[model samples]
Target: MEIFMKVFTKKLFAGAALSIAAMSSAPSFAGENPTSPIMGIPASSLEEFGGREGVRAWVESLFYYIMLDNRIAPIFREFGNPERQIFLNTQLETMVLGGPNEYQGASMSAAHADLGITMTQFNAVVEAAYNACERNVIKYHTCNQLINALAPFTADIVTR
Candidate 1:
């Protein structure tokens, strides 16, 4: 357990540093919220994620990926329960939709502050989410748009 924690810590710092560098180097837009430019295509919305029901399904699929991923599976292994997963899925989807932030859950920074979450784990979750989108028949770019929108929260999430 100690060895694994050490490895996770190494990957965490390295991943966070790299992500910060990459974000800093990228040509950012001049606004509070910037969308990724994908060859002039309009940024996709949460609607493109098949709405709430689809989001729920996607979350389920994503958790499956998370469970299988050795890099981050340990983090979620103890947080299992159907109701908890469903509630999490609902909150995430609601937030993604720009709807009433009915999500009274913990803030990103606070939620992950003590978790030692790394970029590798974070990106793994993103990839899993994208995979879930594909499985749900959501267009790839649309899925990426959601990721792009949520990318800014990376700083709040990585706390190692």
Candidate 2:
């Protein structure tokens, strides 16, 4: 399984890197454009991230990085194929990015209540995710958009 994750991570990196390169060649339509929605994230932004494919790769890469980190891996060590849950994560991200809201999971607080996670651990996970975003070619501004959207859940996610 570890070997499989390694393989998967390699493939995800390769693909995401390519996507990023492709997108970077053109200016992002998400920033300061007429189509930018007044109340929420713009769909063009999500499309820039490669829509479902980009989000899936980001979430999968997030899990891959999490598992690789010794400080954070213990939190997820019990789970099998965290990759399977990437769909749900993708849905939640899509929703955040002004797409459909099909994420039907527990609230972040309710979800992490039993884990006793700390701020340090949470930050580590976020940092690891940012690392993946860097490798995936997700821009800094776009990544911050996601962080801002999910910030409200910090209190719930960090129980300790």
**Runs in model 1 lying further than 4 Å from the true structure:** 1-44, 79-86
Model 2 ranges with Cα > 4 A deviation: 1-40, 79-81
Q: What is the overall TM-score of model 1 with all chains considered together? A: 0.66
Q: In model 1, how many backbone clashes occur?
A: 0
lDDT for 50 (candidate 1)? 62
Candidate 1 residue lDDT tens string, 64-151: 8888899888887754464576676665454544422344455556667777888778877887887788788988877765565455
Pick by TM-score: which candidate is best? Answer: 2
Each prediction's RMSD over C-alphas, in Å, is 9.0, 12.9
Steric clash pairs (candidate 2): none
Candidate 1 deviation (Cα RMSD): 9.0
> All candidates' lDDT scores?
0.60, 0.63
Top model number, lDDT? 2
